[model samples]
Target: MVALDGPSGTGKTTVARKLADRLSAGYLDTGAMYRMVTLAVLRAGIDPADAAAVAGLADGVDLEIGTSPQRPGFRLGGEDVSAEIRGPEVTKAVSPVSAVPHVRELLVARQRRIIAEVLGEVGGIVVEGRDIGTVVVPDSPLKVFLTASADVRAARRSSQDTAAGRQSTVADARESVERRDRLDSSRTASPLRAAEDAVPVDTSELSIDQVIVALCELASHRGLLAGCSAEAAR
Candidate 1:
């Protein structure tokens, strides 16, 4: 198993998906699970700050998460909400909603179950989120913490938002990223942090392919690329 942990705007989701595809492994965007709950909370008109209420709501939410890197899907109560969970509304509320102790406990259990199932079925899986390495899968064979400069991360976020049809500015993106960083890093339950054994990768000057190649090399060295093709392991 591989654990990719990083804050928003660090390209964790894209990198994790691509890496899983290259390695022929399953992928899990644990953040999307939290976002799904956040969307559910918002749709119910519940305050995100109300941890008790959010936990109660999350308890009964029927969330189905797909592990396919090529076609990940998130369904809430039989409603496909993959795109809705990425919108600004859920992005803004997800941190607080996920911060709830019960919510984290619930989702972490589900995440572990999914990981175990995927590992049994596929023999490998790449899981990405704010706390994957530190909380979700600390014993993963490989753990990577991706990082980039603030300005670069903000620009990347702005470009992504614009590409997704959301009106965004660099300034606004920077503020949102910074705010999320603060909230995630300061959360008492399973805070955003790198595991002690995690490898740190600074992506400020590396393209996506370069980052993937670097991770592939790390995996190869760690014996995690046993069945991967030579081209992919290169």
Candidate 2:
């Protein structure tokens, strides 16, 4: 397993997918699990602040995750709301809802199963999120802590979340990312943190491709990608 933990940007999602492609491994979008739980609680008409209700909602709902593009499943209460869970409202509130102990336990178990299934095959998985390296898969073969300045991360967030070429104001994006950073770090359960042995990759001054090259080199040097295929020559 390759645990790619990072803040909002730093290209963790894109880089993890590309790394998985190069190594012929699977990719786990762990953030989506949190979003799924948030969406479920909201749709169930349960107040997110009520921990017991949320826990019951979590138990009652089923989260099925598949990586296939056409039918990526994040079903809740027998309804598929994969796309809805990724929208702006859930995006902003997920951290708070996910911070709850019961919710994190539920989602973390699911995440472990997701990674375990991929491990059953010869191909490993590249798991990406805020806490993957520190908590979700602490024993992953290769752990990377990707980071960049908050300004850079917020700029990237604005670009991706906006429609067309327009974006939320830079300040708006910065505040959003900062709030998430604070909440992620302050949370009691599986907080976002770099694992003790993780290699920190600061991408504030690096291009996406440059970061990819660096990670690929690290992977090879660590022998994680020694016999891998599906890569294009650098």
- State the C-alpha lDDT per candidate: 0.92, 0.79
In model 1, which regions exceed 4 Å deviation? Answer: 227-229
Q: For each candidate, C-alpha RMSD in Å?
A: 1.2, 2.5
Give the Å error, residue 202, model 2: 1.2
In terms of TM-score, how similar is model 1 to the real structure? 0.97
lDDT of 1 by residue, 87-180 (tens): 9999899889989999999999999999999999998999999888888888888999999999999999999999999999999999999999
TM-score of model 2 vs. true structure: 0.90
**lDDT tens digits, residues 1-234, model 2?**
788998887888777777777776777788887788888778777777787888777776667676532334666657777668767778787887888898888778888987888878646888888888778888877899999998999888888777534458778889988998898899898888889999999999988777777787778778877744224345
RMSD of 2: 2.5
Candidate 2 residue pairs in clash (backbone atoms < 3 Å): none
TM-score of each: 0.97, 0.90
Q: lDDT for model 2, on a 0 to 1 scale? A: 0.79
